[model samples]
Target: MIRRISAALLALGLATAAFAQAAWTDAEVRKVDAKTGKITLKHGEIKNLDMPPMTMVFTAKDKALLEGVKAGDHVQFAADKDAAGEYVLTAIQQKK
Candidate 1:
């Protein structure tokens, strides 16, 4: 019974997280920490973040997310919220 309950709770959590209504804005890469897999950024407009204008450091999932992007380059992407409630770069594009 306990195992079943845990499984149900986990499923519910995953579903709720999958539909999260989060957003992102166009940002430029400031610097990347290869060791930590994090990137410092200068963001233009992150509507959902509601943060003040400044550079910020964020965790990156892998080195591939940094491909085709560089410091001072403009890019657009949205963060993805996983079942564990962690946000990561899920979509990205060079500003056109």
Candidate 2:
């Protein structure tokens, strides 16, 4: 029983690590929502190894980071998967 419990914990740790996201690019920003810290981004095509091509709205962590950016500006951004597994922007920079 102890061995099984250990194995289960190990598996859980691995699963958590797998879900912890590294980073991603937004490609472009379509809209900015400061009130809720959500951004509508026209992102580049993302073909995840475990998923398929898709585009959607993303919530960013720092709404202030979008100060000078506009709907048309291209940005190289990074995101982290939230508790619910939805992508949330964590870092970003304007792409010249």
The whole-model lDDT of each prediction reads 0.69, 0.71
Query: What are the TM-scores, per candidate, against the unseen true structure?
Result: 0.56, 0.61
Backbone Cα, N, C clashes tallied per candidate: 0, 0
lDDT of 1 at 68: 65
lDDT of 1 by residue, 42-80 (tens): 776565545555667766666677766677878776654
| Candidate 2 per-residue C-alpha lDDT over 1-96 given as tens digits, one digit per residue, 9 for 90 to 100 | 999999999999998886565345557777887778887777665434243334567787778866776788888776657888887877778875
Q: Using alpha carbons, what is the TM-score of model 1?
A: 0.56
Those runs of model 2 whose alpha carbons end farther than 4 Å from true positions after fitting are 1-26, 46-54
Please state the error at residue 7 of candidate 2 in Å.
25
